[model samples]
Target: MDIIKGVPLTSYILLCSILFAIGALGVLYRRNALVIFMCIELMLNAVNLLMVAFSRYFNDSNAQVFVFFIMAVAAAEVSVGLAILMMVYRNTKTTDIDALSKLKY
Candidate 1:
């Protein structure tokens, strides 16, 4: 659209980079599994944004198709990941990654 045309590709790249960095930092510094999972989703969305930006700039459809696939995969990942997290929380009463060490036995 006209709005997208006004923005430069570099700006999009920079924004996505910043988002990815924040996501990475959250994933590394946060102890809660749910927060880490949300960060992972943030990272994935950054990549998706980049892909859509590039696809629009290049007037290509393949990148958009890939984005759809990525969304599908993300959806499946979220369902399975949340299910596992729920089970873990039910068993351990906590979502902290460090708390999972008790499973070492």
Candidate 2:
């Protein structure tokens, strides 16, 4: 396979995979809601990086378009999520999701 820049395709894929795994681990292990949110962003970024790599390799623009959509969604999600988090903190004085009880009225 032809090299993309100075790096090989296999290396790029492995790096993206590692980034995704780390993000997953962070999301799974973190207790703070903000940290979890950040981890989710990390995962999304990893996916975006992978998509760009594939787009470049295939000489296609579709993947880039998909990535743009992903970025838009992520931005909207962060905005709404932070707004909700602020609301939750204002009501409860905490952002620890484990302390949340959805059944409480």
Candidate 3:
């Protein structure tokens, strides 16, 4: 645990894990779809940070490739998710997913 080594890998990973956990909790507890989307983004960023840390420590290109793929998937997911969110907002006049209870069909 060299405190002078300019941020240890384990510390970076632990911080990322904590941030991801906070994002997960926010998604679980928030009613607004937009806020949940933001939390999901936070979690994605955390994963990206972890991947970057691993890549740096191991001098590996595979982790960087994986991070790029994750970014692509996240971009696609946000595009589709925002479309659905717009529909939800149009129908309910609110972005709160919990407020839309008519999806039982």
- Candidate 1 lDDT for residue 73: 100
lDDT of 3: 0.91
Clashing pairs in 3: none
- Which 10 successive residues of model 2 have the least lDDT summed? 1-10
* lDDT values, one for every candidate: 0.95, 0.93, 0.91
Tens-digit lDDT string for candidate 1 (1-105): 356546789999999999999999999999999999999999999999999999989989999999999999999999999999999999999999998886698
The TM-scores, one per candidate, come to 0.93, 0.90, 0.89
Q: Which model is ahead, 1 or 2, in terms of TM-score?
A: 1
lDDT of 2 by residue, 1-105 (tens): 655577776787999999999999999999899999999999999999999999988899999999999999999999999999999999999999888988788
Best by TM-score: 1
User: What does each candidate score in C-alpha RMSD?
Assistant: 1.6, 2.9, 3.2
Which parts of model 2 are misplaced by more than 4 Å?
A: 1-4, 102-105
Worst window of 10 by summed lDDT in candidate 1: 1-10
Model 3 per-residue lDDT tens digits across residues 1-105 = 533467789998999999999999999999899999999999998999999889888889999999999999999999999999998888789997878888777
Stronger candidate by lDDT (1 vs 2): 1
Off by over 4 Å in 3: 1-5, 103-105
